[model samples]
Target: MMNVTRGRTPFLLVFLACTGLLAYAYYAQFQLGLEPCPLCILQRLGFMLMGLFALLGAIHGPKAWGRWVYGVPILLGAGWGMTTGARHVWLQNLPADQVPDCGPGMYFMLEYDFPLMDILREAFTGAGECAEVDWSFLGLSMPMWTLIWYVGLAVFILWALVVNSRGSRPLEQ
Candidate 1:
């Protein structure tokens, strides 16, 4: 062992937790029975990118550029999350009789690889209807949470990035 101390563990833990969440979200959609919309896909991308940045920072040590790398995904993920949340809000605001079609009709995503493209295709085109909120937990709908999480994740990522950046600068003795 390299004799890693307690101080370093928290950062590692946070990285692992984020990575796990991203992995689980993707698995839930692809393996289980959830299909994310375009915005959902964007969120996933954000998570994945963030995870990658964190992993690099953790393994190689938080370097000069590492903070910016991490921040990029965090901001992107946050933006995507907002879009998803807004989409849901739009749907919620619509009248029962006037709900627009939110169904995925993909002739684009299908142009990629088989397994993922299939999954992507299903994600957009297969979800019965986009406007209909199919599920909710506690008092909030999934999209609502997605929105909250997006804003929250952005803040968190920024915090993490700042810490990493500060840590990167050597202190004057």
Candidate 2:
């Protein structure tokens, strides 16, 4: 039991980290008045997915093969976020004239009953609004920071997996 609990530490940490990030995102949106663009919303979803998987993994605390099951989804979530972040960063770096024209807000598109594919296409294509670097820390934009976090979290999970692979001894009765 102790060994199992010990193995869950990493998952719990990941979950907590995700929670903090999400909370800060909300703070940025409401308090800081930084509206999230379409790509930002998608990035948030990815973080949510990763956090959900990490929470489940911690609660389950399964040994051996079970780790792989949870780890895969977490990695997928991270990859999803990383890809979105990369796209956002690329958009931000584009020359002024090259930036795509701003599109309708996600809410507006949904309210108007736009096709799902169309919504996705517009979001991925990245509007002029998405290219603006409104928020930054230490010279890195929000998307750049998100990309760094995704990569860092993925690496942490991978390290945890490797460490857990070394079989633990069963507790004595």
Q: Which candidate is the best by TM-score?
A: 2
The candidate that achieves the highest lDDT relative to the unseen native structure: 2
Misplaced by over 4 Å in model 1 are 1-14, 23-32, 63-65, 102-104, 107-128, 163-173
Which parts of model 2 have CA positions greater than 4 angstroms off? 1-6, 166-173
Give lDDT tens digits, candidate 1, residues 54-135: 5665665544554565457547656755765676556666687766544434334555444675655454344335556645
CA lDDT of every candidate: 0.57, 0.89
The per-prediction tally of clashing pairs is 2, 0
Error in Å for residue 77 of model 2: 0.5
58-118: candidate 2 lDDT, tens digit per residue: 9998688799799899999999999999999999999999999989998899899999999
Residue pairs in steric clash, candidate 2? none
